[model samples]
Target: MRRSLRLLAACTIVALVCCGCGTIAVRKTSNVLDYLYPEGSPAIPARDVTLTLPLRVGVAFAPGGTATRRGASDWVNATAMGGEVTEAQKLALLERIAEAFRDRDYIASVDPIPSLYLAPGGSFDNLDQLAQAMGLNVVVLLSYDQAQFNETTNWSITYWTLVGAYVVKGENNQTQTFVDAAVYDIPSRALLFRTAGSDVRGGRSTPVESPEAFRAESAKSFEEAIDDLIRNLADGLKVFGEEATTGRVRGQGTPEIEVKAAPGYSGVAKFENGRYSGALGPVELGLVGLLVVAGLARRRSA
Candidate 1:
């Protein structure tokens, strides 16, 4: 028992060294999305004076499958254990995005029609019929994938233990992720956009002597990986015309964000709306602090 306990403690420490706080903070602190579809942009018919957007979209699980997670609970409690987002959650993501566009007077709607994955028998042909039934113009299909690196090697120094760590995300054999995305122009049958999430730390496994500790550490990566994808899509959509929808949609920008940190602390702002565009680091809000602390506690327990 003593040996087991000590091993657990040591492994837990090592995991924390690699994981930091292990919790992603999704705070859209402040952002303002405003834009006009330029005549140069994709031209579509303005059926009504209101010009309802051909804005039907989807939220799906990673194209193939989600990496299996053992030890602790998944990064997002709401996300299903497997790689897929729940039906309700997918709907929610699309709905919120639709609402955002609508708030800006861009008439849009989320197709009630399930995605190809959700409806196996349903294909693009069926989708056309379904969209026509709902009076939808274009349909957008979305998916996501992620990769994480939590490399921590241990070496004994002359007097102290050295835990070699690389917490910042990287792609390698020891990573976990969820990714894959595509946008279809139902009207023109054109491929407006298609891309995969950053599979940086592809298939790299974080094997903790303590599975629980490893999970606690890995969950943060998983959560943040997904959040990063979402934020990229959201912010990219929010800023529409300033940049191409490709690289930006996949989080390939030089700018950084400013967010809010711990109490009595100031951090980087999370999102980059038309009003503000840049990169954001970790936040230090009270809620996030609690989460981080909890991860720390879990690490300690491990």
Candidate 2:
């Protein structure tokens, strides 16, 4: 019994070292620009615009020789696991993105751009063509890069301090995913918004693992990161465009409507017909003074 207890204790220590062995660090890099609408462009009231999420999701690697090669290798390995992204996963990803916009009421409706309309690489250069094909007023272009690394350390297990094998190895795997999104006005070919988000996850695995494990872990990391990315993206949208409130629609660059009140004008302002038809004259000025006095009186009485 004593000998067994000692062996169990050693195994526990080994497990701890194998599980919590390595150090991992991650950094985020991004550039976000405020939303820009050109002069004289129509105010895209949320309820009046239709947005599309193309069926094809883009995958891009970081530029530079080594990083690009590494990214390509990682993508190849990721795809080899479970043999490519299944139809269900693809649909889920698309629906998730659409739902993000729908929850915010950012557009009148969300539609999926057919895969046939997308190019082989899923680049955004053909966005104008896609918008024309789908009749979409707004197009959201999505692209992402994923980088993964594995570091191995030397460790061995012994049997009763006697003859033992040193073939087993422990590994530390770290993954980082960076996402970029841009919103475009199809008709004008204007880029209305641009933003990015990144996430990193690290863990330890034994036996050097399989591609399947890597795929599953990477997918989980991506899902978590995507939620935050969508949230940030939505927040950024609120800054650029107007959001509808309970009783009013909020927006910038909206055309002002002229208010004309006849003789019995009781609300807010009073109008007098004269040379200055749309101008606020003495009667309108008097109405404003009356309102201010009445408001002050009511407050005092209360």
Give the best candidate by lDDT: 2
Most TM-score-accurate candidate: 2
Query: Which residue segments of model 1 deviate by more than 4 Å?
Result: 1-102, 111-117, 120-122, 147-178, 194-223, 234-302
In candidate 2, where is summed lDDT lowest over 10 consecutive residues?
Answer: 59-68
At residue 41, candidate 2 shows an lDDT of: 42
Please give the distance, in angstroms, between residue 281's alpha carbon in candidate 1 and its true position after superposition. Answer: 25
lDDT of 1 by residue, 54-123 (tens): 3445333322223433332112221222333345544554554445444332323444343433333233
List, residue by residue over 1-302, the lDDT tens digit for candidate 2: 99999999998787555533433322222211212222344554433322232212221121111122222121123333333333354446556677765533224446654334554433334554665555565666555556666544443233123232222334456778776777655544445556666678876554324344556766776676667677777666654433322112224542222222334434322111112346778999999999999999999999
lDDT of 2 at 205: 52
CA lDDT, candidate 2, residue 181: 71
Candidate 2, which segments miss by more than 4 Å at Cα? 1-90, 114-116, 120-125, 156-169, 242-302
